[model samples]
Target chain A: GAGVSQSPSNKVTEKGKDVELRCDPISGHTALYWYRQSLGQGLEFLIYFQGNSAPDKSGLPSDRFSAERTGGSVSTLTIQRTQQEDSAVYLCASSILTGEGAFFGQGTRLTVV
Target chain B: AQSVAQPEDQVNVAEGNPLTVKCTYSVSGNPYLFWYVQYPNRGLQFLLKYITGDNLVKGSYGFEAEFNKSQTSFHLKKPSALVSDSALYFCAVSKGPGYSSASKIIFGSGTRLSIRP
Candidate 1:
């Protein structure tokens, strides 16, 4: 697809288990971002990867949450020991640069039970 | 710091009626603001943006927004509302030129727009 693509549109995971969400950004995009959106809430910034620069993890809610962008293309968000509060739609976006507008994926909806 | 706010949580308008969605922002110097919309079970779609040039910016789907520096508001406006326009609207802000900021965008709480038939 020309736009950003995410895998496993929906996931139901058991608590205390681990889950990984994947995102494939648009080709040629140098910047990628991850955000969390709970029900009836706005998007919360998570981590960001820009070229070879260090990612900004300021918005990461906890240590258990981590993400990595391999080869500056594919990105994965991993959550360990899933908790109910961790349930939300994980959104991924990619852009040509920091100044350019981003293209978003449909996002992965994860539910922890 | 940079942030955006949508004062109304929800807005209702009859079909063919004019509609306006209010948005405000606060940032250190100038702001590069944007508006996005989301339909049911979808990610956000970019609508319009206010960068430099003109204060009145036109966007997709017959939607336009006026940037008011004095009021610090960028209200999305449509001449005629359509039933299909019912969805969630978000206002976001980022650091503009001269400021060293990343692609991080701060979104508003989102306003649920309901266009009645």
Candidate 2:
């Protein structure tokens, strides 16, 4: 793909429901990251995956939040028992390497009601 | 741990005037700083980065940033502000010389830049 891509541009889920957000990183990118942003706020780092190394999950907010990157390409961020506070935009980014600037997707807007 | 901060929540500038968005960071290792801009309903766009080079770094849209190691600040600046330049700006930092699996970009709280005609 020409750029990073995220699916389900907008999602409306009921509280306590599980939602899965997906990200398709740019081809050949060795690094992929997930971040959450509240309306008119800063980005909160969630997870980072680099090549074949174990992912850095220190930023995950809670036990209910989890993510997996399969085949070093596509990633899925799963939020179990979504709460109202989970409503926000989930952003995905990819870079050729860790030190390089990362490209971001338009983001998936999740609304938990 | 590496962390970045944008002290001001918002900045207002007149069109055609110079503008600056402030950022400061802290890190144990070498700091790799970056500036990103986000327009409404859009994704974050990379502005510029300071890895290891001259203090001044130029980026897209005629924007530039200065990396001040002594001050621990990377401030984004533009000579002439345009209405179109109004956006939410973020400052990020990572500890790096390169290719470190443990390194991840840490972002600031963000500052909203508003340019008025």
Candidate 3:
């Protein structure tokens, strides 16, 4: 892909349902990140992946939120038992290296009603 | 611990006037600073970064940033503001150089820049 790509640009899920967001990063990008942005809020870091391994998961808000990256390319963010507060734009970014500027995806607007 | 702070929630500037968005960071080691812009209904776009040298780093859309080591600040500046330049700006910081495993970039609370025509 020319840039980072995310699936299901918008999602409306019922409360307590599980939602899965997907991210396909640019080819050859080794570093990937996941962030959540609530309405009128800043980006909240969720996780970071170096290759297929995630060394930084300290930003995950709770046990309900989990993510995994496979083959160092595509990644998935799963939110279980979603709540109303979980309604936000989930963003995914990938960079060529750890310290480089990351290219972001269009983001998935997840709305839990 | 690497963190970034953008003090102002918003900044208003007249079109064609110079504009500035403040940012400060805290990091254990050498810092890699970055500026990103987010237009309405769009994802973030990278502007500039300060990794090694030349504190005055220029990036897309005539944007530049000064990396002040002593103050731990990387402020985004533009000589002339455009209506199209109005957007949400984020300042981010990572620990070290490229390829460092510990360089997890942390972003600040974004500052909304409004350029009035």
Candidate 4:
């Protein structure tokens, strides 16, 4: 694709419901990152995938937050039993390689009501 | 640990006047700094990066940032401000192998830049 693309630009889900956010990164990018942005808050690192290696899940806030990248191209962020505090924008970015500038997607706005 | 700080929550500048967004960083070793801009309801766009070499590095949309190792700062600067430049600006710092095992870039709280016409 020309740029990073995220699906379901806006999502409103009830508490305890499960939500899935998808991200398709630019072609040939080996490094993918997931970030969460709360109202008036800066980007919070969530996870990172580097060329199909075991993803760095250190930043996942809780056990309910999980993500997976398939074939090193597309990724999905899954939130189980979502809470009101989970309402925020989820952003995805991909870089050609490690230590390079990353290109970001428009992001998915998730509203947990 | 590597972290970034954007001291100003908001900066008001008149169009055609010089604009600056302050940024400071803390890292164990040499710092790889980056500046990004975000408009309303849009994703962040890379403004510039300071990897190595000259202290002054230029980037997209007529933006530039100066890397000052002594001060532990990399402030974004524009000689002449434009209304279109109004947006949220973020400063980020990453720890290279020389510094720490974590290679992820950490962003600051962000500064809102408003250009008054």
lDDT of 1 by residue, B1-117 (tens): 677889999999999999999999998777788889999977899998888889999999999999898998999999999999999999888777677756577789999999999
lDDT of 3 by residue, A1-113 (tens): 99999988999999999999999999998988999999867888999998745459999999999998877779999999999999999999999875678899999999999
lDDT measured at residue A28 in model 2 versus the true structure, 0 to 100? 99
Alpha carbon deviation, residue A113, candidate 2 (Å): 1.0
Docking class of 1: medium
Error of 3 at B94 (Å): 0.8
Ranking by lDDT: 2, 3, 1, 4
Tens digits of per-residue lDDT for model 4, A1-113: 99999999999999999999999999999889999999877999899888857888888999999999998889999999999999999999998844567889999999999
Q: For model 4, what is the C-alpha lDDT against the true structure?
A: 0.90
Q: Write the per-residue lDDT of candidate 3 for residues B2-106, one digit (tens) a residue.
A: 889999999999999999999999988788889999999888999999988898999999999999999999999999999999899999988776434655679
Best by DockQ: 2
CAPRI-wise, candidate 2 is high
**Which candidate do you rate higher for DockQ, 1 or 2?**
2
Highest TM-score against the true fold, candidate: 2
TM-score of chain B of each: 0.96, 0.96, 0.96, 0.95
Candidate 4 docking classification: medium
Higher-TM-score candidate among 1 and 2?
A: 2
Tell me the spans in candidate 3 whose CA falls farther than 4 Å from its real position: B98-100
Winner on DockQ between 1 and 3 is 3
Alpha-carbon runs more than 4 Å astray in model 1 = none
Tell me the tens digit of each residue's lDDT in model 4 across B1-117: 678989999999999999999999998888788899999877899988888889999998888999999999999999999999999999988765364343667789999999999
**Winner by TM-score between candidate 3 and candidate 2:** 2
